[model samples]
Target chain A: MQWLTIYKKECLESARNYKWVWVPLVFILFCIMDPLTTYYLPQILESTGGLPDGATFDIPTPPAANVFMMSISQINTLGVLVIALITMGTIAGERKSGVAELILVKPVSYTAYVTAKWAAHVTLVLLSIFVGLIASWYYVQLLFGDVSFIHALSTAGFYGLYIIFVISISLFMNTWTKTPGLVLFLTISIIMILNLVTSVFSHLLEWSPTNITSYLPSLLRTGEVGQDLWLASLFTIVTIVLLLFGAIQTLKRKEIV
Target chain B: MIQLKNLTKTFDKQYAVKNITFNLPSGKCVALLGPNGAGKTTTLKMIAGLMHPTSGQVELANGVKGDIRKYIGYLPQHPQFHSWMTGMEFLHYVARLSHIPKHESQKLAEQLLDRVGIADAKNRKISKYSGGMKQRLGIAQAMIHKPSVLLLDEPVSALDPIGRRDVLNLMEELKQETTLLYSTHILGDAEEASDEILLMHKGAIVESGSLQDVKERHQVDKITLRFDGNMKAYKEKMEEFPFVTHTDIQKQKIHVYVQNVPEARDVLLELVSKEQWPLLFFEVGQTTLEDLFMKVVNEHAMADHL
Candidate 1:
């Protein structure tokens, strides 16, 4: 019961943060970007005094889902950045700012305090993803016409988990240092490193949730859960669990000095 | 009630607090008094459950120790709040942390803001509140749930005279229900507000008990003497006077606190005649709190110097 009070307070605070607003706005903008680029590039080239040669072939019809598909990369970039930025302060900011001393004076332990904080970040990321999905739905319906609800929901769900995974990684990152910026950087840098490694070294990167960002959406594309299923499942579950456990343990032993 | 038995806390292989033993009976206010860096805050933190003692244990006299935590409200020295929150919001958060229901948390939050004298700025962020206002809010947050034990660490530091008066009054007001123990560097504030004073020095409570008792035990013989001319000759003459332990001369005045003040009176008069030190005033009295503090601090320094 008491935990719910803290959770509610945290949720309200997340709502007030501007990053929550920026997440959906940026992602929605990114989602519409590919379609706009596809629609205009041919015209732009033709206007440039016709291809400069007699042999100019027509551009292939890109898939109507290209705009929505671009959301994958968007999620890995802006989504991960937003996740880290929002959750960087999950524990370290409070500890560094000395607010932990104020809050811990009550019956609230460091465990409950940090758990509620991460819960807030998760809720924010989830809400932002939901907002982005609504905007995507509007744009896809207007531009592509009739996106499968299953595709949209599954894609949104996968991205939601990815965002949570990013935020959780940040919460774990907090234990290493007490700076919110540094912790957030570590979260983004780790995700980016894994992403780069998987793209360049397929055999080396197949061990973890390397393809979850790219492959999770493939589940939506095919309406089946085959894209990096084993790796994504293992990585998402293990990363979240390990990170949350690490966050809880680090916070539990945190000294307010 | 709160009892700490052999409570000692060590940090980085050094004892930050050692052999702390005391009991705070319910409904009484005890002051943990000390100078800067005296481990007063450490002892308070240990009692507040913010830090664990390396040795021994703290026992609540009435309820189970764990249960007692539910009834404890702590105010840190530089009380920190969520900077983005209003005084009302901060109080509400604390209310909820204290397990008040959502409805009651909001309701009590308003009432507490009023009680702490910040109801006017209930919607403004805490970062914008004045220091005195912030300190009051800190106190308000601590007492919001009406905890049974209120441990305030330098609760009145940032308060002005009127604010200090109000906070002290609030503490007195809370005495009917809560066991209050606070630490402060402000000796006068402690003297004015506390029934008992725990004088901490070198990570240990060197002196404690009723304020009057501590003062009485450490009282020095005091003499205020006024002379017409410079007190230089008189000061030098009184240094050799029988029973005169020490003397400090300031202009035409001589301030002396001696071991045998009664015996020094006649010698003082004789010195006035011999040295032609024109006397304007001569008086004797008991030591004040400031005198006791200086004596205790200097004695410790002298002992360590040896």
Candidate 2:
């Protein structure tokens, strides 16, 4: 009941601050732009640039699945930035402003406090991802070709797992530090470094959470679930749980001034 | 009832709150009196379960120990609320966190708003409220759960005079319903509101007792005499008397600390009449709480140097 109460407050906070509206809108913008730009590149280039007299450009439209992958790449960069901006102040701001001191003095447990924040963030992340993916799916069908609903769902679901992992890491970092700017920097840098390492050494880190992003486009195209995909999903889920646990412990030991 | 047994907190190898022990009786108002950085906030934080003690423990009624935050309500030195939330909504959120049922939390929030005299501004965002209104709201939120023990840290320190009066009056009313422990550096506020006082210095309690008892124990009998002209000879003659234990002279006035006020009064009156001393004013008085506080603190400082 305590966690539910805190979770509801978090939900109301996000809604009132228009985070629910703006975050999803940003995601949808990225989603729509990803495919539209890919489809209209030649026309855009011709309108913007004066070509030489005999220059003729030929550009082919990519496959529907490839457009979805382009959207994933857009989210991998801009979407993560948006998420970081949205959640950078979740715990650290509360602590700095002394709100955390008031709430922590109540009868609530540390686990409930951390979990409630995680749940609220997960809700926002999932809603934003779902809205963006559905919009991307609709445009991919119109601009490219007919894309299977099941494949699109699988792609979104796989990508959603990676987003959740990033959010969990952010929350963990927030609990560990008092500076919101530092937390945001550390979380983004850590995730970026991990993704780079896993991608550069994919042969050695096949089961890393970053592999979820790499497998998402393939899963959308072929509609096949691989053993490594399953292993990566498991690893992501375990890492999320472990990060949340670590956050709770860190908060428990934190000296709230 | 709550008992702090040798509670200590250290930060970066420095003791914020040293090993301190005290018991708070139920339904009584106790004031934690100390200067700034004297560990009052640290002690309250440890009791509120916001910070774990480096050593020792806080034992509640029935000897139940470990996270007794449920039985305690705490307001920090500067209580911060979600500025975007209406006063009523914030109280409702606090009630829920206090484990009140959802259906009843709304009613409790409304009742507490009225109780703390913030009902008129209950619908206003906290950002729009004045300093006093916000403090009243803080008290409303802290009382929403009806905890047995209430702890407030410098609740009136940041307020204007009117705000301080309003909070102190509200505290007076609340002290009757629950055990209250408030920390403050203002001796007048503590003297006006608390029945018992725990005077802390350098992270340790230098004095603790009922207000009347502590005042009585440290009270010194004294007399003051002011002259219209220079009274150097008169002051020297008065200092030779056996009854006058100490004398402080400022300009033409002499403040004489005495062993027996009646005996000193008689001796001083006879001397002033015989020598035709220029006695412009005279009065006898006992030491006030302020004087006792200064004396105790000065003695401790001197002893520390030794």
Candidate 3:
């Protein structure tokens, strides 16, 4: 019950800070930009007049699925950074600023505090990603060809897990340090290392969380979920639960020293 | 009521607060008094449950079984709030955290705002409030749950003189409602506002008792003399008296310790009259709390050095 109260406070604070508005706006912009550029590249290049005289370049229109996947890929880099940057300060900054002391001194449980924050961050990220996927799906249908709504929905779900995993990393890092800058650095570094290990051993890493990224776009292209998708999803979900539990324990141990 | 049993905190093998024990009786105003870095804040933090002690524990002595923090309210040295929130909004948020129902939270928040004298500023953003207003808001937020014990660390140390008076008056008004244990280095405020005093030095309590009892325990029989001219010659002359134990001058006033105040007062007055000394002012048997604080702290420091 207290967790729900705290969860509502976190959401209100995020809205007050315009996080609810701008994060989704950034996602939508990234999603829409992908299709617009893919469709207009040939004409944009021809109108520029910077190419050598009589020089020719053939640019083919990619499938709607490719455009949608490209939009998500664009989000995979910049949008992840935006989410991490926003979440980096949620715990670390509050703890350093002494606001955490103000709240934790109450009767509230450490689990409630950490869980409420985790839930709020996950909700915002998932909602924004879903809205972005839908907008991009519409643009792709108009400019290219037909891509099923189910594919877009599945893409958001798989990729949403990856984003939530990133958020978990931020929360875990937050409990380790009171500096937002340090949290951001550590979360990004951990994510980069995970991605590297997954790519270097793709054939062997069927259970790796980063495998969900590759499986998502392939699902969009082939219209069939990969055999490894469920394994990777299971792995990501388990990691998220463990990381959240770790953050709660870390906070309980730290205790505003 | 609350009791701290041998609580201690250490960082990197160095004690931030050494073993400290005390009891806060219900409905009493206790002041934790010390200079900066004397562990006053650390002691308060441990009691507030914001920091855990390396050894010992803090528990409610009122037969409460659950979390002691549920019955406690804490205000830090520099209380920070979400500046974007209005005064009323912040109180409502704190009320919700304390699990007060939505229907009653608004009424409690409004009442607390009026009690702390910030009701008119209820709708104003916290960021735009003055330092004093912000401090009042912080107090209101801490009291939302009507906790049994209220812990404030240096509540008025950051305020202007007027703000200091305002908060001190508020504390005076609030002591009747709850057990108030606050920390401050301002001896004058402690003398004015608190019923009990815990004097801390170098991370340990050097003295603790009711205000009247502690002062009486350290009380000295002495006469203060001020002259129109140089007081050093007068001090030397006074030191020659058989009953005078020692003599010290502060701010041109000679403080002469004596064996008996009644006899010393009569003898000193006779001498000043008979010798026709230019005595601008004379007083007897007045030992200020500042004098006791200095003497106690200096004595402890000397013992440490020895």
**Per-model TM values vs. the true structure:** 0.89, 0.94, 0.94
- Candidate 3: stretches off by over 4 Å: B63-66, B227-242, B262-281
**Candidate 2 global CA lDDT score:** 0.88
Q: List model 2 lDDT by residue over A1-257, tens digit each.
A: 89998899999999999989988998999888989988888778879875778987667678888998888889889999788777778998899899998888888888999899989999998899889989999999998998899989988988899999989989998898878998889989998899899989999998999888888777887899888999999999999999999999988888776
**Residue A86 accuracy (lDDT) in model 2:** 77
Reference-based TM-score, model 2: 0.94
**Tens digit per residue, CA lDDT, model 2, B1-306:** 998999988889988888899999888999999878889999998888888899999999777767788888888887899999999899989899988998899998988888888899999999999878888888887788888999999999989998899899989999889999999999999999999999998788889999999998988998989987676767788899988877777556787889998888998899889988778999999878887776667777888899
lDDT of 3 by residue, A1-257 (tens): 78998899889999999999998998999889989988988778878875687876668888778888898888888888888898998889989988888888888888999889999999998899899889999999988989888878877888889889999999999999999999999988888898899999999999898788888877887667777998988899999999999999998888684
TM-score of chain A of 1: 0.85
Q: In model 2 chain B, where is the ten-residue run with the lowest total lDDT?
A: B245-254
Ranking by TM-score: 3, 2, 1
Question: Residue B213 of model 2: what lDDT?
Answer: 96
Model 3 per-residue lDDT at A108:
82
